[model samples]
Target: MAERPRVWVSQPLFADIVGRLGEHFEVSATETVVQHAPDAVAAALREADGALVTLNDAIGAAQVAGAGRLRAIANVGVGYNNLDLPALSAAGILATNTPDVLTETTADFGFALMMATARRITEAERWLREGHWRQWSFESLLGGDIHGATLGILGMGRIGRGIARRASGFGMRVLYHNRSRLPEAVEREHAAQYVGFEALFERADHLVLVLPYAPEHHHLVDAVALARLRPHATLTNIARGGLIDEDALADALGAGRLAAAGLDVFEGEPAINPRLLALRNVVLTPHIASGSLATRRAMVALAVDNLIAALGYGPDAGRPPSPLNADALTHARKRGA
Candidate 1:
């Protein structure tokens, strides 16, 4: 019998769903969640034919330097910033990500967070729980209004479009800024107008960040950008945390330069800036934008499908559904790897 290919799962995932990989490969799954150091990640991938990783694991050139056996990496999230594409391509390894499956779910959470920030939901709850809501004072717990407001979205991707569609029911005037403008039909369908980057900050009553992270986008929301926002505007980030300068945000919120903020992802996540925690106006959540049970399961299933196919064992063998670097597969084949 031919030897079965080996695979590594970086963190504990849905047991039954990930167990499916066992049928075709020798699976090495971590029992507990771990913050893998670069060297540790390299050690694990050194012997595996493929890996199933989440955002928690960072894979780069040094990690895959001599990982000749690593052929594919199935990322369980839409964003692949955790994986260094150039490095993986040089290593002749295919990469796949789970997209579309979490689009609506993430958008739902993004809008919810925005509303919560605008209405001071969590802040109110905390105050009420602390016995501060003695009576309905006219000016008590005042917050920005959502209905008939200008909703500005950065990054007009699928999730951004979903948020815009939801905004229509609230009678919001939607504006968006992206790398390029969406087609006229799409703009009409969502009733979203394209605007320049600075104009988005100036015109928005509420601004939501859904842009993917890139090196150039690091700290895109610094003090200068925050100053562009109206003092009454709310800022919500359902995107990557590295996109915001948390200290600058904290300063803005502390000084009341901005109304409020809702953040789902933070820089150095699982360990947030203490400054944000001190601010009462900022609402923070552990990254759970795609936390809906059904959607999360779908993401895992898609990743499983990608892994099985990329490893050349499933019905769609050699044709992963969402390959990030398909050319790597061809390169591997040419070298008879």
Candidate 2:
């Protein structure tokens, strides 16, 4: 008998969906959602043939350095920043992510977060719960209107376009800034106008960020950019936490420079900034943008499919869907040949 290839599941995901991997390979999955230490991740990959990971697992260069058998890493979320692409590519490891499946779900959450921030929904709930309902006067808890407002989108990706289409119902003029201009037909389809990066900050009454985070975009929305926003404008971030400077955002909220802000992701997640916590104007949520039951399940299913295909199993064997590093396989074949 031949030894079966082994795979590791970095976190505890849906059992039924993860069990699919066990059909084709030996599976070692964590029992709990844990923040794995770098060395621990390295050790697991050192033995496993592939891994199913979430954002919680940070697989960097050091981790892949000793991963002699690691052929693939299927990330459950759309973002692959948690996995070091350069390191994985150099090590001939295929990296795949679950995208498209969560786009609409994430857009829904982004809009909901924005509306909550603009209307002070979360703040009002806290106030009412705290016995402040007695003070609910006609003029109390004034919030900005969503209808007929300028909705600015920082990234014009699939999620951002979904948001733009949703905005059409509210009759908002959509302005967007992306790395490149979307096609004219696409711009027309969503009724979104392409604007310069600074114009997006200046003109939008409510700005929603759906941009993917990268090293160059760290703290992209600092005090300087926040200052450009109309004093009454609201900002929503369903993207990466590192996009905005928490200190700058807290200062803006505290000093009344901005109307309000909604944040789903944070720079230091699970451990929030105390300064932002103190402010009432900000709407804060633990990262759950793509957290609907159906969407999460679909994401897991897609990741499982990606992993199976990546490991040379399933119908799509040797061609994993949504591969970030398919070239790694070519590198492997060249070396093997």
Candidate 3:
């Protein structure tokens, strides 16, 4: 009998779903759930045919070079920044990310964060907890209204489109900006207006950043961009960190250049800018936008499918659901390497 493909799961995940992989492939999972440093992941890949990793695992070219048997990496998040694609492709390795599974869940949190920021929920709670809510006054915790407001979305991708769809129910005028505008038919269907970046900044009553993080997109929301926003505008970012300049954003919120902000991911995660922490107008949450138990489980499950499939084992072997570098498949087939 042919040997079973070997998979090393970087972190402990849904046991039952992981067990499914074991039925068709030999699976080795970390006993404890923690981020594996790049070196550790590379070491495991030296012997593994494939691996299932989360955003915490950093799999790069050097690691891939050492991984002679490694053919695929299954990332459990919608974001593949954790995986170095150029490096992986150079090594003739396939990489896949779980995208669709977390869209709705992350969108739900994005909308909720926007509401909390606009309503001053976190700050007011802290004030109440600090014994500052002595009397009720109409002017005391004043915040902007959301109803009948203009909602501008950057990046008209799946999650951005989801946010725009929700805006319709809120009676908001949906405006979207992307690399190239969405089709006129899509705009008509979603009741959205296609606008330029300048117009989105100038007009949105509430702005949500839902763009992907890329080299060119680093610090996309900088001091100058913040200046274009009205003082009453609210900002919500459910995208990657580095998309916004943490210091510049804190300054805007601190000086009242912008009304309030909701942040889930930061430029340097787990360690946020101390300035943002001191501000009263920001709603901060650990990076858990797609962290609902079910959604997270589904993400892991999908990633497992990717790993097993790419390894040419299991029910859907060789049939990865979402291959990030699709060209790799043709290369894998042509060279037969």
Q: What is the C-alpha lDDT of each candidate?
A: 0.95, 0.94, 0.88
- The digit string of per-residue lDDT tens for model 2 on 91-154 reads 8899999999999999999999999999999999999999998878998999999999999999
TM-score-based ranking: 2, 1, 3
| Candidate 1 wrong stretches, greater than 4 Å | 334-337
Query: For this target, which candidate reaches the highest TM-score against the unseen true structure?
Result: 2
- TM-score comparison, 1 vs 3, better candidate: 1
- Arranged by lDDT with the best first, the candidates are 1, 2, 3
Give candidate 3's whole-model lDDT: 0.88
**Tens-place lDDT digits, model 1, residues 64-178:** 9878899999999999899999889877899999999999999999999999999999999999999987876999999998999999999999999999999999999999999
TM-score of each: 0.98, 0.99, 0.96
Best by lDDT: 1
Name the runs in model 3 displaced over 4 angstroms.
Answer: 333-337
Give per-residue CA lDDT, model 3, range 1-337, as digits (tens): 9988788888888898888788777888898977667687778999988888888788888777788778889999998888888878767789999999899888888888998989999989998999987786878899888889999999989999888888888899999999988888989878999888989999999999999999999999999999999999999999998899889998898898999999999988778899988888899999989989999989988988888788887677778988998776665666464
Alpha-carbon shift of residue 299 in model 2 (angstroms): 0.4
Q: What TM-score quantifies how close candidate 2 is to the native fold?
A: 0.99
Better model by lDDT: candidate 1 vs candidate 2? 1
Which pairs of residues collide in candidate 2?
none
